[model samples]
Target chain A: MPRIDGPIAFRGGGFAPSDRTWAAVATLVGVVALWQAGASAGVIPTLFLPAPVSIARALWALTVSGELWKNLSVSLMRLAVGWIVGTVFGIGLGLAVGLWSVLRSPGMALVSALFPIPKIALVPLFIIWFGIGEGSKLVTLAFGVFFPTVIATAGGVDNVPRGLIRMGQSFGLSHTAIIRKIVLPAALPAILSGFRVTSSIAIVLLVAAEMIGAERGIGAFVLSAGNLYDTDNLLAGIVVLSVLGLLVSWVIGRLERALLGWR
Target chain B: MTDGLRLTVDGVGHRYGGLQVLHGISLTAEPGEVMVLVGPSGCGKSTLLGIMGGMLAPSEGAVRCAGDVPPDCLNALTYVFQDFSLLPWRTVAGNVALVLEDRLSRTACAARVAEVLALTGLTDFATAWPRQLSGGMRQRVGIARALAVRPACLLLDEPLSALDAQTRDLLLEEFASLITAAGTTTVYVTHNLAEAVRLGHQIVVLSRRPGQVRDVVRVDRPLAERRAADPDLMALEQRLWRMIRDDAAVAERERIDASD
Candidate 1:
């Protein structure tokens, strides 16, 4: 093969640069346009699903009345608390399981057994055990986030090269020094990726728990609107959840760039 | 401060469960000398080096690092790994600073790091991450890190084996001069006879498994004079090769049989 210093021309057809933002905006706008046209033409019933304009109006009304903010704040607070609790314990236990052979077998077995059970199914049990309040909802979200974090952290630590550890030993590094300097940095990329998954799981469980037994949250508002056949308000609440997901993914993207730039 | 430091492997033997790797291996690397252990594949050279570096305990006999170490010195021995073992998250300067962080003052550590980086010709790439460097450059960083510790003895296990042939040849010369400049007792293991003749003050040849000493050839000539083209060095390489040729063939056949 001949070597060239400048940018290589692509002969094989694969990835190419294009107007990605324009394409995304155009698709979304086209869908809303089609929906509006269908509703105006009376082809789609308004009771089952509202037009985009009606949903936007409902969203604007909620925003101005401060109803949206009230529900959003409560939901965000729950997510923050539950996710933090799960993450701290998950990382702590995961490091233990990964570093010590004694903990590996039992920890792995428990994670495997519990991780597969549907977390939403446990909400009723949580309510019974912790009482029907913030405790149950918080526990629900924490349970959802915990198992995946443990799995990810342990896997990350396991993937660190044995050769690097040996090198640390030969250089006369203490156990604590080796773990802090070598093992943690090597496992960081994997752990950060785990955060992305656990965050999504938290959002899912948060909504589920809120919908089941809560007076103030996006999930509660959406549930009430659906029962009253208020399609515009329901769709508006759904849009809020979608936007929250987008914001979260954007934050994670920035974190990846900041932390794992060496890769 | 590094004077009178010697690494002695006295009757060191090792066995991995049912497989015996080395037996009754004895050698001493004196102050400011490089001892090269050369043999065929699976001759247990690396295992012996591991024992000497205090990374492993021999099943029989002992490894002794005998000499006076300064009261201020934190590490007596350091190793250069064959795999370049550079942490991907750390920059070149960060990797070299790791060993010095515990023992030296912040200002002193920076000075030591700069000196070693300059010695390895890596001062230009101090802030660059390991992933951005080529294999040879990364190994240079590894060497710089090892030298930064100011160890009385250095152990290298086939440190140039992973590089491409041309890069290996180039770095081998750099390594020879760097070792001479450091003037620390060193034990290096390699399968290549040419590397053995070029770098070793004393070249030790070991036979096939249950590896025992076959010969110890002392090269009293200067490192610069031990060139590939020089007749004397060529003769030494040939002599080393002849000692291992029959055992290497036998080891290869046994390996094939074991695999089957």
Candidate 2:
């Protein structure tokens, strides 16, 4: 053992701790700077790869013209509605399967059978069933977000310590009280992490749904720009989607910090 | 104080499939007495504790609790598990308040929680989460939670085995006093002989594998007067050790024989 001290420090070949914010910012700035330089020098064709400044200009024009917000808001609305529907239902069923043996096997079988089928592949089928409108698009996004949430929530519930459950039982806690006071709080970390995964899935499905048959989403904006051969606007739409994903992730991170502070 | 409940384990035998873990183990923890079960590893002391606590069913025989359980008590028999089993999300007071929530009025629950926290010397850490506390402190929280219910019987499964030697020694004295003060019939399972002698009014020594009662020794001296340096305590520890020692050697030989 090392000499007794204030604290023992073990160097296990792990990455040294540092302020990573500056490094992350520097990497992004460096990549954009290199792209801008290449575009100006004509080594990369402007049509093939728009300069960062040009993409920014297109984004500004779309924003000022109120077009970007229109498409972006539509995508956001679809995402919110679909994700909420999927999450609420998934969590309800997940808790059922987690707690009740009668439901576990059947629920697990259905999830396993459906989880592997690429959700995007079912878009045309959804369109036929629900009609080529917001209904079909909402269904597409909801279906895509549903399965992973179920898997994650059920797994989280399963991971709660058996000792805690036994403690609840020994104390003569009612079934509802045991679930509400013990199981839910103990399993919240896993359930919240499941939310993170399902939201990402919802985003992917949102874009795909819009691409197939939609008029006013970021995906639709990109598709129209592609048809018109406007590379700058297409890249601008892609940038908006990237920022949306980053914002969702940041929100989820904040939720985790707030809810899982006990950890 | 009203007499505590009598927990009787009558010729209890337990098995997991074909493997017998305990056999013909009969014992009684009398009201207001501390009964420590001591044995070698794999001797099924914990399994027996679990059975006595009504957490598991014995393969043979039965465990019965008889006496006046307080009418308002939420749990007549509560357990302190080896791992502390404190819910990470709840504060010290909140965890203690858990069993009392449905059983008592809101103010009564809070008062009971406060009382138990004080009893366990955890009043200052009422709002602290389990993860913020040391291992010894967490176990105190466990004790506080169990005591909050004012159970007729307390079943402890190696409550001090997880702590370091110094912490164990320090807590052992506090534990002895606290249990004495509570005066609830306690069934404590431990591998430590010193702890057995220090805490138990009666110590039950068990043989290795398919554990059966080898000897039951009663300590006549009061807990407070039973010091580590006392010859009688030392002698009792040695006697208990000797009882388990032969069984341990025989177990080792049997294990080797089977492996070969």
Reference-based lDDT, residue A230, model 2: 98
| TM-score of the second chain of model 1 compared to its true counterpart | 0.95
Query: lDDT of each prediction vs. the true structure?
Result: 0.90, 0.91
Q: Name model 1 segments beyond 4 Å from true.
A: A1-22, B70-72
- For candidate 1 chain A, the 10 contiguous residues with the lowest summed lDDT are A10-19
Q: Compare the candidates by lDDT and give the number of the best one.
A: 2
Clashes of 1: 0
Writing each residue's lDDT as its tens digit, candidate 2 over A38-77 gives 9999988998789999999999999999999999999999
- Given the true complex, what DockQ would model 1 score? 0.79
> Which segments of model 2 are wrong by more than 4 Å?
A1-19, B252-260
**Least lDDT summed over 10 consecutive residues: which range in candidate 2 chain B?**
B67-76
Q: Best by DockQ, which number? A: 1
Give candidate 1's fnat, 2 decimals.
Answer: 0.97
